[model samples]
Target: MYGWIWRHLPGNAWLRALISLVLTLAVVYVLFQYVFPWAEPLLPFNDVTVNDQ
Candidate 1:
């Protein structure tokens, strides 16, 4: 899959690398800015339960 993407990207190796970095950063930014926040309330990570003995 990654090889497919690498092949699809335009330009030489250096430009491809730069484009990959920018694409990676864009994905991270979208996840943090929209996806994670939208999904946070549906996740159980912060829902802690402490049992008393």
Candidate 2:
């Protein structure tokens, strides 16, 4: 999959590396800004319990 993307990206190695970095940052931004917020409530990460006897 990654090899395919690298092949499709325009220009030589330097330009492809820059493009890859930008693409990665964009994906991270989207996940943090939208996807994670939307999905957070459905996940059980915050569901904590404590028991005392």
Candidate 3:
């Protein structure tokens, strides 16, 4: 299955690498901005305290 799909795509090695890098960075950005906050409490010393003047 994987081999057949790769054979159909007409991009060179460098093009494929660039596309994968961009996609990975996009996913990481989304996770850090949204998903990471929800799981912060589960991590040790991850609490963010706010002070009001």
Candidate 4:
């Protein structure tokens, strides 16, 4: 399946790179703005506190 996708996508390297970058950014935006915030409180690191004495 992966090989078929690679073969059929495009012959232009730049175009493929650009499309991959756009898709990555879109996924990151959705994760940060929606998914991450919703799941933040459940993360173990969320309870860490800083103490300056």
Candidate 5:
């Protein structure tokens, strides 16, 4: 998969590196801004816990 992306990206080494960095940051930004928030409630990572009564 990574090889596929690396191949699909245009340009030589320097430009490819820059574009790859930008694409990575954009993916992270989208996940944090949209996907993570939407899935937050469904995740079990909150600080709260309940003891069986």
Candidate 6:
């Protein structure tokens, strides 16, 4: 999968690296800004219980 993307990216090694870095940052931003917030409430990470014994 990664190899395919690298092959499909335009230009030489330096250009490909720059584009790949930008694409990775964009994906991270989108996931944190939108996807994670939407999915967070459905997850049980906030669930907490304390028992006194």
Clashing pairs in 3: none
lDDT by candidate, in order shown:
0.99, 0.99, 0.76, 0.80, 0.94, 0.99
| Cα lDDT tens digits for candidate 4, 1-52 | 7456556667587787777677679999999999999998888985779999
Per-residue lDDT tens digits of candidate 2, residues 1-53? 99999999999999999999999999999999999999999999899998997
lDDT of 6: 0.99
The true-versus-predicted C-alpha distance at residue 6 of model 5, in Å, is: 0.8
lDDT of 3 by residue, 1-53 (tens): 74665565558977776766776799899999989988887787856688998
Q: Alpha-carbon error at 3 in model 2, in Å?
A: 0.5
Using TM-score as the measure, name the better of candidate 1 and candidate 2: 2
Pairs with backbone N, CA or C atoms under 3 Å apart (clashes), candidate 4: none
Give candidate 5 misplaced runs (Cα > 4 Å). Answer: 50-53
TM-score of each: 0.91, 0.94, 0.55, 0.63, 0.80, 0.96
Candidate 4 structure lDDT: 0.80
In the predicted model 1, the residue pairs found to clash are none
**Which residues of candidate 6, in runs, are more than 4 Å off?**
none
- Rank candidates, TM-score, best first: 6, 2, 1, 5, 4, 3
lDDT of 2: 0.99
State the displacement of the C-alpha of residue 41, model 4, in Å, after optimal TM-score superposition: 1.5
**Residue pairs with clashing backbones, model 2:** none
Better of 4 and 5 by lDDT: 5
Question: What's the distance in Å from true for residue 45, model 1?
Answer: 1.6
Better of 3 and 5 by lDDT: 5
lDDT of 6 by residue, 1-53 (tens): 99999999999999999999999999999999999999999999899998999
